[model samples]
Target: MAYLNKLRLFIRKPFSGLCDFNRATTAQCRKPLPIWLRRDIPPAGKIKRVKGILAELNLQTVCVSARCPNLPECFSKGTATFMIMGDSCTRACKFCAIKKGKPAPLRADEPQAVAQAAQRLGLSHVVITSVTRDDLPLGGAEHFAKTIRAVQNQLPHATIEVLTPDFQGNLDAIKTVIQAKPDVFNHNVETVPRLYPSVRPGANYARSLAVLSYTKDFAEKAGKRIIIKSGLMLGLGERRKEVLSVMRDLRSVGCDVLTIGQYLAPSPNHHPIVNFVEPEEFEQYHQEGLKMGFLAVASGPIGVKLRQHCHCYGQTAP
Candidate 1:
């Protein structure tokens, strides 16, 4: 009977793209966002400058590609998280909207351009991330490190965070990123172990945990505190225990900060949101995570990894 109901919802919202999932695990639909919710977003001070800098650097933001709800608020603050390694992605996760295609050769100049953009925007803290680039031998680890170095050199005062790929679990690549030493080192273990094939088909659940643990271990060995952070999206058909399991995994690696946000499918072709998570539920999880040992926790209807609220604090992942 529940299956029939979910099927009906799927048919009515054909663009929801959850056909690939089993209905039983998903949550029931919640109320939609109010019109006022859209209108009340914190403003991005000057969009002209935001658009102009993006055009100048010829760069793309996960804000635009993933259709983040937080874009307006973050850009209004004169801060933007830049996506590196080209717009093309090697992995085809159901939740992501970044383009998937054969990647182009790396441009030798992107590192400097991103740094210059951060400087131009006068960003005191910048978030840098990229689509997974499996085609590259080191999984684009060198590029991630280089970009961090360039940004730091240009703005010594800027607090830089690199939301890096797992580099297919290559310890060396992980080391390379840690060596560059961004203020915050982040890798999203996007979902639970069971959902790997369905939601994150190209990513490994365990490898991600290992990467986080190893990153901290390496940093500790070098005596450089690097705060390790990770995020997960709700409304992806995961159970409460499953989410809790992920939290435990992250804690095992001593992840300092955590983000739990509602996952909204980008388009009809993307993974359908199993439900629209309610603000109260997010609050519940936030409170529970504090019990579980996350130093800084952000979980709400509006949580994201690139905003003022997204900054994290931890032990070695300084």
Candidate 2:
């Protein structure tokens, strides 16, 4: 009887405008790709130019490796989140698109290569992220420090931000990256704790919160002022109350920045989308995050725009 009811729900057409699960067909129940996720066609020349630069530097970017939907738009703008270490990830998170396996050896010259790419692009603000490298002794913390220093060497005026893994809750590794003095230290919680087992089985919700908290304490003790940032994804079978609670947890840890976006399944085999969050709900989240005392909040279906805003802090673009 339960299976029959599910089948009935699956065959119905979704209501127009809003994503009404009750009336949604199987395709709609799967959260039909929304219009907002789509991007306008960028000039082919600009895209090719950026690709050539990345190729010449022998660099990898999460924009490419993770199959981010904003690739075309970001590539057109000649901006990318440099994914150092390598393109392969060690953990197999259900929601991510990056390849999972035994990663190849880290390239010795990757730091300088990333620096050169930033210089060529004339980026005033550079964001760097990497695949989870649990196999490394320090979870690739040293490599991250080296890349940060290299980028600074080439562009001393640029503000650097790092979106990193939890280092498996190794405070020493987290401190290593902090000592590098990235202007912004971002580690996303990804989703609510209730969904962790299914969505991010390799990660721990409490441990992630501790990482953020410790980063803030360490920075203050060292007399270095650094902005702490974290993000979460909606439409991942998370309740609205759970999302707010996650925000509170982050704020409790002195997190200064926040970003929220809808979860788009990377493939049919990956985690299925629970629902398509409406744009108005995203706006509500943005306002609520601000009320929670976050220095900045970016939430919407247009994830690329939200991320750009979060990184920029509403300052003049780079």
Candidate 3:
């Protein structure tokens, strides 16, 4: 949404060089996906104080908003990727279940709340994410930085991973967040390049790459190699070659961690699944990625592949 709005608003914009708006809507590949796909995944343990901490802190999470299937598993382990800002998103990607519309203002207390949640959960690794805040000045990058800083202030020793949006290609805005010094900078590339317009309609591949590239480049320049990570959803009609190409692109940008999960549509309104990536296949890709020299690779059915990798690598956060 921001991309389109900016494209229409400014004749020549920075990201305009990255995506072609005219060629965005041409893909229409279709394939029959398996029917018995939707299943409730159960976690192995209980996060003792999770709900109370969330209620007390007034924080929201992609785990709940996007109905991430890994919620129980992740939460039960006393770890969470706290979704900062709020529940509403600025854009409506067809593949996402997060509510779409003009989102509300940033909750002034959220940063402290997330930090509190981390402290209460004894979270050695805290993952913070947000809905695309295209409506904000600085695209909410300042808020992201604040949250990371707050969490650090509380935990002081916990590793932090932020799953952020492309800050409308404003390198200055991205710089602000990077300067906050997160343990890992993660921005999901989401899908294959070809289906972006129809699947993640509001985002861009090159822009996504640019975001990762900028984060990695800056982290390196800062004399601290913060782990740079990203994820992909399979079963969206993406090809094997395309997946490998994405891996290569990530590698080229110095991304150290990657997650490849089988896409599971939340509802019929969202994009239908084209297929299910089996666990075996996910393992194949995981090993391939290891061979490719990725420091960590998570690939599997229901996103079980990288579930523990982030914990291990992230726990080492300084």
Best-performing candidate as measured by lDDT: 2
Counting clashing residue pairs in each candidate, in order, gives 9, 0, 1
Tens-digit lDDT track of model 3 for 1-318: 432322122211111100100111112213343333344545544644676678777778676677655565567766666888789888888777789877888888889888887898887667787888888988999999999999889998666777788877789888898999887777878888999988988888999999889888887787755768788888889999999999999999888777777666666667877776776787778777876767667665552424343223223211
TM-score of each: 0.84, 0.87, 0.82
- The lDDT for every candidate, in the order shown, is 0.72, 0.77, 0.70
Superposition TM-score, candidate 1 onto the true structure: 0.84
Weakest ten-residue segment in model 2 by summed lDDT = 15-24
RMSD of each: 11.1, 11.6, 10.7
lDDT, residue 21, model 3: 9
| Runs with alpha carbons beyond 4 Å of true place in candidate 3 | 1-48, 303-318
